[model samples]
Target: MPVPIPGNPLGYTLVYAIDSPKGPVLVDAGWNHPDAWAALRGGLLSLGIEVGSVSGVVVTHFHPDHAGLAGQVREASGAWIAMHEADAALVKLMRGFAEEEHHDFQADMLRRAGAPAEEVGAAAGQRPWVPAQPDRELRDGDLVDVPGRTLRAIHTPGHTPGHLCLHLADADRLFTGDHVLPGITPHVGIYPYDRDDVDPLGDFLTSLERVADLGGDRLLTALPAHEWIFPDVAARAAEIRHHHEEKLSTLAGLLADRAEPPTIWETAAMMTWNKPWEDLPPMLRGMAAGEAAAHLRALEARGHIRRVQGVDPVRFQALDS
Candidate 1:
C-alpha cells in the first residue's frame, strides 16, 4: 500500500502487509502524519483487514518515513513493534536527548565538515522526530514475529547502522526498505563526524554486494519501500554499486588535480549533483558535504587518500600528495 507522506518529495512510502493466522504483519508504517495514518487504515480496510487487527510491525529502519506510524499501530491493535538492535539503540539515545543538545551537536558536526556559518546554522535547525521504542530488538538472520511466516531479517547497515532487508522464505520475495530503492540511491553518511575510520560508504557497498549475491537468481522480485517495485534485486544492487564506484573514481580524479587538500564542503561542491552546487540550499549542502566525507573516508580506508594532518576542519588529499 502506498501511504501518503505530506510535503515529502518522495511522495509516499510503500508499506507492505503480510498475512498470518494471527493477523497481518506490517513491514513498514508510513510517516506519522494524520493523512498517512488515515491512508493506511483505509488501504487495509479495502483489503478486508482492520487496523485494530494488526499483529505486529517489523520496521526496516528507524527513519520517520518507515517507522513513524509503528507506535500508533501498536496503540490501536496492542501489537508489538520490532526493529534491528542497532536502530533500537539509536531510538533510545535520541529519545533521551534534549533538543538543544541535538541542535548543538549537528551545528558542531557541520562546522567540522567545513560548512560555512550560514550553512551550519541552517542545517543545525533541522531536527529529527523522536521514534517509537521497539519492544522486540532483532539481529541479522532472526525471523520476524509473524505467525506461520518465515520473514527473516538481513542486517544491511548502510543508510542506517541497523537497516534491515527482509526475505520471505516461503515466497522468495525480498522487502528491501530504503536499502535498495529502484529509482534513487539512498543517502549514506557518517554521523558523529569526529569519529575516525567510520566508513559508511564502505559499509553501503559491502551491503549492496551481499544483497546482490543473495541467490544469484535473475528473476527474484524486490519490493522496495519507495518507487516502483523491480525484478532482480541483484541487478538493481549492482547498478547502485557501480554508480558509487564511478563517484569514487570522480572524487579520486578531483583530488589528484587539486594543488591543495580540500575540506569536505569544498570537495562536495566540486562533485556533480542534480544541479550546480551554488544552487543547492544550505541543508542540502550540509548533506552533500556529509556524503562527500563518507566517500573520502572510503578512499582513505582503501589507502588511495589520507586526511591532512592538524586541520581544524578536516581536509583530504590523494595519498601521494
Candidate 2:
C-alpha cells in the first residue's frame, strides 16, 4: 500500500513499503519539523508500518527539506541513508555557508546588483542558514532495492548541482524533489560556488528533455516545498522552457535598444518588467539582474552579442551591427 506522509503541501510524502525480497525502503525523509514527523508517524501507523520495519532511506538530494532529518531517521530506524555523491561536497559547503558565509555572500551579491546598502544588509539578515549533511552517496543509474520496488537515480542538476529524481521502472512513477515544480518556475541562477561548466539553465533544459524522453505517460509526483502536487510533468517542463525563451528574448531586445550598449544594471532594469526599483524584492531584483547579465554573456560567447566594458558598468549590444 502507498502511504502518504502528512504535513507537506503535497499533503503527504508518498512512501511505499513493498514486500520485496529484502524488507522495506523509504523514499524520502521529508521536512524536518515536529509536525512533519508527527504526520509521517501517523501515516506509518495508519499503514501499520512500525519505525523498525523501515529498512532503508533513499533521498533525491541533500536539500534540507528532502534530506533534513535523514540522519535522525537513520539513527532511529537503523536504516542506511543514501544520496548522490556529487552533492556530498555541496552538503558540507552548505553547512559552513549557513553558519558563517551565506549572509555575507547574499549581502555582497545584492550590493553588487545595486541594491541599497541598508536593504541588502536587511535582506541578508533575514536569510536562514541551517545546514545538514547526507550519509551514504548515490550515483546516477544506481538501483535502490526496495522490498518489491527498484528506484533508479537520475542526475537532474539545475536547481542545484546535485539535484536528483528517482525513476521507478515497474510503476512508471517519478519522485521529483524541487527539480520540476508544477506551477512555479524553478530558479536556475548562477551560484558563486558553481564551476564554469555548471550552466544551470542549460542543464535544466537538457534535464527537461531527458525527462520527456523517459516516456511522457509516467506519473510525476513532486514535493513542492509549497503548493499542491501536480501530476503533469511535461506540461510544467514546457512552461519553464517557454518562460526562459521569453526572458532571453526580452534580454536580447533590451540589448538591441542601445547603440552603445548599457551596463549590467541598466540592462537588468530594462529586462525586468519595468518594476519600480524600490518596490522590488532585493533578492529578486538581484537575481533578475544577475540572470540578465548571464544571458548577455552567453549571447556574446555565441557571437550573437558584443560586450563593452565602461567605467560605470559593463554593457552589451546585438552583434548584427
Candidate 3:
C-alpha cells in the first residue's frame, strides 16, 4: 500500500519499488523537504526496501514538486535521473531565469494587466523558482526499459511545454503528472517568453484524446503537484475538455456585450467578477488575465473573435457582431 503524506493536498505520495530485472526503479522523487524525504524513506523501509536499492529515477516533468529531490536521490542511491528532452531545456532555462528575470517578469505582467502598483510589487515577492537540471533527457514515444516493464513517454504539453506522462505497457498503468488531475484542474496559462506558435491548450486537448485512445481499462495514477491518485482517466479527460469549451462560450458571451473591443485586462475583469482586482494576488491576477487573453487568441483563430489594434493597445471582441 502506498503511504499517505498528511497535510499534503495531493493526499499522499506513492513510493513503490518496481521489481525490475536490473533492480528496483523509483517513479518520482518526492520533495526536498527533510520531512518529505524522511517520510519517503520511512515508507520505503516499511516495504522492506532501502534507498540504495533504487536503480533509476524516472520523472514525468520538471516541476519542483515532482523533480525537486531527484538530484538528491541520485546522489544518495546512485540512480540515473531521466526526464523529457524538451523539458530539460526548460529546467535549465527556468533555473537561470528565476534568479535574474522572474520577479521583473511577474511584476511587468501584472502591471500591464492593470494591477495596482503596490499589489504588483507584493506579488513579485511571492514568485518561487527552482534551480535544478535533469541528468538525462527522455522524449516522446521513447521506451524506458525497466525490469519486466516498458514505460512509454507521452508528451502532454500545456501546463508546461515539456510535460510528459509515462505509460506502462504490461501493467496498463499511466503515470500522469500535473497534466491531468482528478480534483483541481491543472493550470494552463501562457508563459511570458513562450512562442506564439506553440498552442498549449490545443496540445493539451490533443494529448487528452491520445490518452483516451490508449483504452479505457488503463489504470491511471497521477502525481498531482497537489492532489490524490485518481483512477477514472477518460472521464477526467472529458471533464477538462468540457471545461475549456464552456470557457470559450463564456468568453464569446462577454465579447458580445461590449460595443468596443476589450483589452485583455478588461475582458479578464468580466470573466473573474467575483475575484476583485484589488483582492487578488499579483501572480494569480496576471495568470487570470493571461488565460483570458489565450482564450481570446484561440477564439480569434476559430473566427469567433477579432482583434483590433489601436494607437495605445490591442483590443478584441466577438467576430459575428
By lDDT, the best candidate is 1
**Cα lDDT computed for each candidate against the true fold:** 0.89, 0.64, 0.70
State the weakest 10-residue window (summed lDDT) of model 2: 1-10
Clashing pairs in 3: 10-227, 20-147, 21-147
> Can you write out model 1's per-residue Cα lDDT over 1-321, one digit (the tens) per residue?
999989878999999999999999999999999999999999999999999999999999999999999999999999999999999999988876644554566787888878889767765655668889999999999989888888999999989999999998688789999999998999987776545757888999999999887765545689999998888899989999999999999999999999999888889999998879999877677678778888888999999998888998988889888
Q: Indicate which candidate wins on TM-score.
A: 1
* lDDT of candidate 1 at residue 120, scale 0 to 100: 73
**lDDT of candidate 2 over 1-321, digit per residue (tens):** 222334433454444444455556776676677776766667677777776667777776765666665676777787787778877777776667677643577666555545556856775654443434555787888887664566788888876677777877776667666677776676666654112344666777788877756645655544333345576666777777788778877777766767666655566677654467657666567666656656665566456777654432344668765
In model 2, what lDDT does residue 2 have?
Answer: 25
Alpha-carbon deviation at 264 in model 3, angstroms: 3.3
TM-score of 2: 0.76
lDDT of 2 at 130: 46
State the lDDT of candidate 3 residue by residue for 180-213, as single tens digits.
Answer: 7887677676655222455677777788887866
In terms of TM-score, how similar is model 3 to the real structure?
Answer: 0.84
Worst 10 residues of 3 by lDDT: 1-10
Which runs in model 1 stand beyond 4 Å of their true positions? 99-103, 123-126, 216-218
